[model samples]
Target: MTAEKTDTLIVGGGQAGIAMSEHLTDMGIPHLVLERNRIAERWRSERWDSLVANGPAWHDRFPGLEFDDVAPETFPPKERMAQYFEDYAKMIKAPVRTNVEVKSVQRCAGRPGFIAKTSQGEIEAQRVVAATGPFQVPAFPNIVPEESSITQIHSSNYKNPDQLAEGAVLVVGGGASGSQIAEELMRAGRKVYLSIGEHYRPPRSYRDRDYVWWLGVLGKWDEIKTQAKKKHVAFAVSGYDGGKTIDFRNMGHQGVTVLGITQSYKDGVLSFANDLAENIKEGDIAYLDVLREADAYVERNGIDLPPEPEAWDIQPDPSCVTDPILELDLKEAQVGTIIWATGFKFDFSWLDVDAFDDKGMPFHKRGISAETGVYFLGLPELTNRASSFIYGSWYDAKYIATHIGVQRNYVAYQKEK
Candidate 1:
């Protein structure tokens, strides 16, 4: 195998990887991006045909180009987004080595650089960026019984509603993916069951105002202020929010049954929490109560309100109850399809880096990791709203590129002792 060398090497050619490539090109940094498949292949292959970005087009766009200037407010379809990424690569003339799967990435041990072993060959680089992001591995619940005759499939494998088995379909997650899948299946005339977890659910719009617009007002657009409030905001905004939420009011109209947590699936009998919505609704009510208290406190303390409404409150329907997960004996219900929308997991076994946290996430301060010459991008809360989103990835990429440039400059100054 021939050994190649570059100043910077990027793993994965997805949104994050492509953004980094663009940044490197702009900075005149000699780099190569290694992708196991064609650019944006993951999105192209994994996403369903009707899949649309939860975020608006403007927010979903990358750094250099805007997606559809006229309809920037609308969410772009998956295929269009894929095309946009492909066009981004061509526009920047990014140096990419497609079909090169990186088997392992390790420090040079005694050397100043790192070695990347790939299917094609070996490459050495002074700097490496693991832009693989999350969702590399699909997370499934172990509570699912092995003896069941039902066909189980992760959301990654699900394409269309027709692919699901006939009978009541139980979707195992309540997040964006699960909600959308459940809606789709229900629209296709299937009895859909949605298991509601403690997921984020934001209003689709606030008094005719888009949530993205409010996000800007809430300091989600201001990087410094947002980062400063991360500790306080982390817990509140950790789960899925913003556009990921489904229109629950319409979900009932569409004939989708929302249930609580799945306790167990044994003997073809699926049991769930009886009072799933009670806790969830109570939490929502408590949150609203807190908001009301905070508003009163602000008024008492003579705190000036921001431009938006200061005391806005939402009254959830007290009568609404999420249906309990019926104990369906596999033999009786004969349910065929079990879609686990349980969420995603990260796999980092290949990249032997010491910067990972206990959850296997790379420990980085605004995309710059502890290990010098290494960075992470396209992760939730990495910096701010842009951290996990495509638009956010560009911000992370720019910061990382600047850091790399600074490191390269310092390397130039350092001399062998």
Candidate 2:
């Protein structure tokens, strides 16, 4: 079949892809965006029912559009967030083709461009941008026994309390998703046991302003993703209930059995690491670090923000640290559900290009890859700390689109000469 052609081909019609299309359109660059499913399919279907945007709507939107009917400080539900993207696509008139999956992207033999094999048909382009953001596949540890009777589901598949079997729940991974899900289950009257892991504890709001705002003002959002900072996986905070800090210490008082890291499972008994106290201390250190940073920023700038609250006021007694559940028997504890909120991983195996590192992650200077005509977007820290967020899409998209336009213009000039 004769492959369809465009000046540029963008993969994955999510916020990143659409943002790229918007910039390309503005620069008079003829491009096509291909989505495997509907626009923002992950937000529409992949997310849990009660999930909301991690960032507030005002800060997490495309600069060209604001979320209607959503308060500035409040996080919009997944449905509203998806609709906002759909509306933005229409508003910008992006040439987006839905239900088209790009199976592979490779250089055309004896040619100067790329040929993309999609579910619909082939498409050739001078440049290709892999905008498929992270969170493609749900991941879980291989600790669960294959023959266990307990119902197991990843956090991505969890909907609500009624979806799980009636009993206590063992929620693995104490990242943002795990903490939030564990809290929700506890509130729903389920005996919740949250397995703690290495995670940061940034407050949702501090001193009358959101932590996101503080990060922006303090110039932390633009900081590049460094190797040392990568270990700080996620912040234990929630946006659902008016955006509050997710302290496992406080959660324990409210019925969540905060335990240490899930180590192994055998014969229906799960063993936990005896580092619960250390984990709590680590989280406290992180939490204190953020507060100290905010305080310094306030003092240095002379900003008239509210005074910092006493640490004891916000921090609850870390009772679980001294008395932790080191082991749990599934049958004895009546724990019938194991929710894996470990995290998600990305896949870039389809690209037949030498643009990746030893870890299979695409290595690029900003969004431009070493391989000519290849670019990437929406991956965390692709350029800066904000590169993975909704707001990050604007600048990354503009930079990539502008780069493509400049290269295309130079080629045209050479041909004319």
- Please report the candidate that would top lDDT against the real structure: 2
Model 2 lDDT tens row, 1-417: 788999999998999999999999999999999999999999988878899988898798999998779899998999998999999999999999999988999999998899999999899999999999977789888898767898888988998999899999999988778988998898999998999877777778889888789789867787544534645466676887778887888888887888989999988899999987777777778778778888998899898988867642555555666678888898999999999998888788788988888888788998899889999999888888888889897799999999998899887885435
Ten contiguous residues minimizing lDDT sum, candidate 1: 232-241
The TM-scores of all predictions, comma-separated, are 0.84, 0.95
- lDDT for predicted candidate 2 compared with the true structure: 0.87
Best by TM-score: 2
Tens digits of per-residue lDDT for model 1, 158-208 = 999877767878888766677777877887888877776564444444434
TM-score of 1: 0.84
Report the alpha-carbon TM-score of model 2 versus the true structure.
Answer: 0.95
